[model samples]
Target chain A: MSAAAARADAGTAVARVRGLRKSYGDREVVAGVDLELFAGECFGLLGPNGAGKTTTLKLCLGLVEPDGGSIDLFGYDLPRQAREARQRVGVVPQVDSLDPDFTVSENLLVFGRYFGLSDAQVKARIPDLLEFANLSGRGDAKIQALSGGMKRRLTLARALVNDPDLVILDEPTTGLDPQARHVIWDRLKQLTAQGKTLLLTTHFMEEAERLCTRLSVLDQGRVIATGEPRALIAEHIEPQVVEVYGDGVDEWASAHAAPLSERCERTGETVFCYAHDAGPLVASLAAWPGLRHLHRPANLEDLFLKLTGREMRD
Target chain B: MAADAQSRRTVARASPWRLPAFSLRALHVWRRNFLVWRKLAIPSMLGNFADPAFYMLALGYGLGGLLPAVDGLPYIAFLAAGTICYSTMNTATFEALYSAFSRMHVQRTWDAILNAPLSLDDIVTGEALWAATKSLFSGVAILVVVWLLGLADSWRVLWLVPLALLVGLCFASLGLIVTALAPSYDFFMYYFTLVVTPMMLVCGVFFPVAQLPDWLQSVSSVLPLTHAVAIARPLLAGEVPGQVLLHVAVLAGYGLVAFHIALVLARRRLLR
Candidate 1:
């Protein structure tokens, strides 16, 4: 789409970026890009490391200035009107920036006060906020005492102290366990149900699939593809995948498996067989002795690999 | 959307100076540090008191006996007024340098504050004011010791409270300026050894600025600590100050300029 057309379409967007670009010295970190985040939708920016997902999120928050382009967040220009836009926004940065000096409850109290909430008002909300984070009894505990998951949860709760309309999370569950991840996802779902808009960045395809209603896949500072998780999978990849692995899969692919599958890809010892129908591929794999294979429908991960290429991005 | 437009218009109408953009929300940042300091009150007080107390006894009484009285007061008493100013400078500078650096970089406290409605100006001003307040604690503590030990000559010594706060602002601003440029903790040592140590000696903290050579005296007159001691010494001795307005103006000038510069540098460092 033309840049002006894209911006015109973003009139109802919570955040709109047109031809956004940022560079550091000789390297362009975020090249020309356009994005529009609608109200009350869970939008995801999915990419591997160095794909500029963090930079894009920072640009949206007005934390970093773009080299070129215009960003209108909540109908206000960024950096210039950042303080105003940020009043209705909450952020959970990729790094842990929680104050360790105060007890868990004090962290919330002080954070709320930053948004101009009075001491009485902040104190009144502490109980509900702590309860929401599942940290009810641990309010008196120091930050040092909380587990990683608990700290992440408290960070989330801290973000909500302002009762923001938009919550931006950068890799919210990057280092979290599965149980903790699920709890966060549930809380995020509740927020969306309450008509809160969410913008999250993650490399985990499963996370994007489960949480985001619409997503943009980024690679090397550009948006490679943008759509709903299932739609992107349906558009870019075959319906089924057969993973054939164990001893001599390379030799088997050259002699037998190559003719049976629509497309084949090898990364190390494993060979992924892509097809519209996995039934035929799975049946063909049964004839090969001692070959272990599994068949399933293609997911967002497959589509991501197809769009961004299968090369490992450090 | 109307609210956003209103705020945007307010921002557009804001003065180019940007210094006055600080908000009362900075008090929240100050209150946060106060709460944290309360937990370590005893140890913090002790650390603030110990250095000046050691200088008072070791250099005041121990070395005073061998030296002549200074400006009609005993050497120890002369040293006492200097110690008050010195202690204030140390407290504010240390708080702004080591403690503030850790909060800004290591602990990421500044980042948390910035995520809210607070601006960079608010956070920087909050830190500077908090450092000044903390310095007051040490300055007042030492003032009490000076009074108890008979080093203070008159009730005018009470004026040291505001003077100490001003000294705190001066050094805090200077220290924060360094912090904005510092890449690591190791960068602070250059400031301590080169700037602070030299200021302590030539700024009339250890002896009268008049006692120094003519060229050195010229340099001493420009130092913020010199003005602090000039005002604080006479207050300790219950005498009227000479060049009071000039001394205050110079100190305030250092504070205001350094504060503006620090805010600009910090905004560049943290926001980008």
Candidate 2:
């Protein structure tokens, strides 16, 4: 069974938000969001730019006060008892906010104090946290001297300084290279194994599929769909996709797209053919000899595009 | 009845005045800045001393050589007290504006801290106190210089520490208010030109407020730095300042009122 399936239904609700609403001027950033975060599960919020992912994360933390609705985190009321709730929670923001003046470990040491941890307590945890982030001997390295990936790992370690039960990461690997991304994903998977509930936001479908047991797709300030990654793909998208691209792809799409596929979409120079059965679509694609085609099983990206639409969102 | 309740909620959310609740958590914020400052303390102190050292040498001694004593004191001696207040004001203002704004907006340090158990109130209070503490350091440093130069030999001069602290607190509070409203570093230029510089000139940093026109002296009396200098100059000369309560009251009032307003504005700016 998937981690989300095993944990979500049986798990206690560590955080609950009902009909949460927030607005900046006339633009409603989080329009009536309802979420229940189960303990020991990595729940993801997937959205394009400005799809209210960051705003929703902020509202959940009580960093932004909601215009309407109620939030209960760790059984404490939000924007009121948020401090108490936050004592048990940790957050890694969308953008890094590491103190450039302090060295790598000093950053963790200082941040841990905000959670009321004694200096000795934080100092004791620093070595292990650094080792966890794979920055063991570089504790004295300044923030500016560290590479982008190293800084992000240090940030992840900093979030774990208090040993918080819930860790919220906003697009933790947005600008990272593949190697760096894999390193962070490995760390996050370990966090879930440690039974730390994680709520993260991301624009990467592969990241969501790899790290999250379940996730919610947000668009235009609303959740369009929510389910386990595989379940969501199964429910929303066709089982297979044949993407035809290159020269004469449009002509090939016009000739064979409707006749041979369950559904079709055109984006730029490529046409995606979605079908329940891959055999017939693969057979049909052979007739278009000049066009290059790729056949693969549908995944989270297909589900995301299907639910949030193919329009480019900024 | 429901509409009335809804409107009241809006009013409460947008209230202009609020009494801030402070906690010991603020000290952590203070410690954070203290740790950062400790690394660059030597160079930072050098930078703070350079500007005032130039002002004293050129304006205090050079200009004093040309003019007679003003207000029963040598031009250098009179300028000494003014330098303490003025330097404290600049130190407090710059720390609260540039450094605090960098932590709040540019570096997103406040955003990170807010996500922790600390509230915005704790962060703002800690910032204001740290700025005041640094200004107190600057003010007392000038007091030590004046003492070594044999400008004032009285025990009454010890009042400079608490007085400098008051001046720091008042100006720091005012600077934070501007920081909460500022969109970027460029916004601070307007504040420096319009509010800070004008007050420095009229509040008798380089000269006596009496040297200005009667109308200008009236303007000077209301400025926070003027009250700072009013108490400081007399105390530095081994005399108790007249209306001591009044001067301290004005400084504290500015500090307290501006701090409250800073909290309110910060809420609007940050807690949207």
B-chain TM-score, every candidate?
A: 0.92, 0.93
Would you list the clashing residue pairs of candidate 1? Answer: none
lDDT tens string, model 2, A173-275?
A: 9899999999999999998987788999998999999999889999888888888999989988889999888878877777778888889998888788999
Per-residue lDDT tens digits of candidate 1, residues B1-272?
A: 21243322322222324664777877877888898899999988888887788889799888899988888778888998899999999999999999999999999999888888777788888899999999999999999988888778688888899988998998999999999999999999999999999999999887788899999999998888999998998898898888999999998999999999898888778766
Q: What is the lDDT of residue A281 in candidate 1?
A: 70
* Model 2 regions more than 4 Å off: A1-10, B1-16
lDDT against the true structure, per candidate, is 0.86, 0.88
Error (Å) of candidate 1 at residue A282 is 1.7
Q: Each model's TM-score, in the order given?
A: 0.93, 0.95
DockQ of 2: 0.49
Q: Tell me how far the alpha carbon of residue A78 in candidate 1 is from the true structure, in angstroms, after superposition.
A: 1.2
Least accurate 10 contiguous residues by lDDT in model 1 chain A: A1-10
Clashing pairs in 2: none
Chain A superposition TM-score per model: 0.95, 0.96
Docking band of candidate 1: acceptable
